[model samples]
Target: MKRYPTVLTIAGSDSGGGAGIQADLKTFAALGAYGTAAITALTAQNTQGVRAIHAVPAAFLREQLEAVFEDITIDAVKIGMINTVDVVEVIAGVLDRFQPPFVVFDPVMVATSGAKLILDETVGVLKTQLFPRATLITPNLDEARMLLKKPIESVDQMREAAEELIAQGCRAVLLKGGHLVAARLYDVLAVRGEATQVFESEYIASKNVHGTGCTLSSAIATYLALGHALTEAVSLAKAYVSGAIQAGKDITTGQGSGPLNHSYAPKPMQIRS
Candidate 1:
């Protein structure tokens, strides 16, 4: 028998089991990948909002990465919520050291319930240090606006913002257009030297949309681990996320916006020769 494709997440822990490392692992598991984590922070958060945050020491975060790399054969890495310059540097250092095949970054700056998740200065550090190293960077419109220091409220703006993000650093950019108020959703994907592709789907109205960013980025990383090309991986990932959102819309988990149905219908464990 063959082993499952191993995927690693370097992000924060969500006690709520709906976002961050929890969501990443669930996405990985549902997509038939072996999931591992190197948590950067511990957040006391749930469907409502983040109540408290305890940052993990950079040294400890590095130790976790080293342990994961040394023990498991990771096929891809998804990075989220590196909320400090020190931890950002540590992650960049470890990433440079390992040079993993595929690294997907979800620049998570704000929570669904309107809480700031990262410091302003840390945004600069992430763009300058981490973006260049990532194979793909997925940022929602709000995060895109934060990065570009401008507005992104239209599909035209999303295209412009996505292209600009690519010019700034990441090898490719997937600017999520979920923030736009519309019935039809367009997620812009701009890769280096390729025509931009917009993945459109009917927006599922769901208040339980807590972990989509984490889920999508991790889903893309899992598809990459399964040997899909970057754009194709994104396409597949988008489909997975759409299904999850729709499946979870009718379910209830908490008073606040709940989570997607990641495991409602999981794919079989993916194997590689």
Candidate 2:
């Protein structure tokens, strides 16, 4: 029997099922890749906001990573919500050992509802250890601002931040523009020694965008696992997220922000070759 491309998500678990490991797995399955997860934290959250978070022990997190790596061939990895320094170190150690082909770091320092997810200490660990190992670091405006320790007010600022992140050892950076108060959504992809590419899309007016970032990163990882180039994967992932936002706009999953329609254009899994 042929084997399917497998994408793994190392992140927190959102009880709301809209973001984090839940959204990552949904995006992976929708994009025709098998999904696995190693949850770093369990959060009591909803569309409104996060109420509480319980982080898993670092040893257990390592065990989860080992269990998956020993059993399945992880084609790509999407890492999100490493809330503590120990958690970040543990994940970094696992990645160093396994060396997955495509490692996409979402750098989920902040949540959609404006909650701080990662601790200050973990930021240093992420930049020192995880950032250098990532194939691509996907950071939204707030996360970028925090990482670079500067305010990003415009697309120009986004470009500058991407360059700085690249200098910190990230192979590539996808600086997200969702938080920008502009009519056009612009995402900048910057790689070392290459001209940066900008992905522009019409900003869809939608409140159901809770997991948009997670879904997009996971989609990119899935496409990359299926052998798409970085630029192509990001372009397609942006389009997919835009469509998901549009599809889920009118639906209400909770009292506040809702989830994207991850399976809106779901395709049947192809026989692995």
Candidate 3:
């Protein structure tokens, strides 16, 4: 029997539809994967900023996970905004039980609009519980700084941070350098027992960068679900994101930062035997 490359997104809901669960699902569809979602939190937000957050209970989250995993064979999972310690524990436990093939953890701490997303207390729990389970931890400069408690101002620091993050128990790290002030943006990838590799793209000067992290991680998960190796998955995901950003540069979605044009080059859903 043939099946669609199915990827699940465990994250929050963005009413704005640019980032979080919405972005994850969009990226998955754009990259030819079937997307499912379990909402951890719901944010009343727009491209301008997050106004309010309503968290889903841990028990409900557990139910969502069990319902999906018991029926659908999830190929990969893209994790985003976990707003509380309980949510972290629930997701970590579910992952342990199901053991999905690929888990892309996008440590979403801050919004592109400069709003804090995750609680300070939840940070430690995420590191301890989810880091080890993640196939790849994708963190931008600001999120990396919060996790490492140090400055990551240059490409050198980005490379070093990827290795340092690997010491925290993750199989790999893709330290995103989009936040750095430079002509070219670099994302450093460091896998356990392998040399670090760097992915570079020209800095696209645009305000439509709201969901870049979520889009990139979800794209990676989708590619992984579609049978790409980890390194190749990251490379292809980067290209997809760069193209999305470039294609959406001139488009306006809101009063503030806009979203990537996810449907710019959508592919038909992929299938596997």
- Error of model 3, residue 167, in angstroms: 1.5
- Report the C-alpha lDDT of model 3 over 1-273, residue by residue, as the tens digit: 999999999999999999999999999988888999999999999989999999999999999999999999999999999989999999999999999999999999999888898989999999899999999999999999999999999888888889999988889999999888889888899999999998888898999998999999999999999889999999999999999999999998989999999899999988789
lDDT of each: 0.92, 0.92, 0.93
- TM-score of model number 1: 0.98
In candidate 3, how many Å is residue 99 off? 0.7
TM-score of each: 0.98, 0.98, 0.98
Candidate 3: worst-modelled 10 consecutive residues by lDDT: 178-187
In the range 98-214, model 2's lDDT, one tens digit per residue, is: 889999999998888888888888898899988888999999999998898899989898898999999888899999988999989888999988998888899899899998889
User: What value of lDDT does candidate 1 attain over all alpha carbons?
Assistant: 0.92
How accurate locally is residue 103 in candidate 2, as Cα lDDT from 0 to 100? 95
Best of the two (1, 3) by lDDT: 3
**Candidates 2 and 3, the one with greater lDDT:** 3
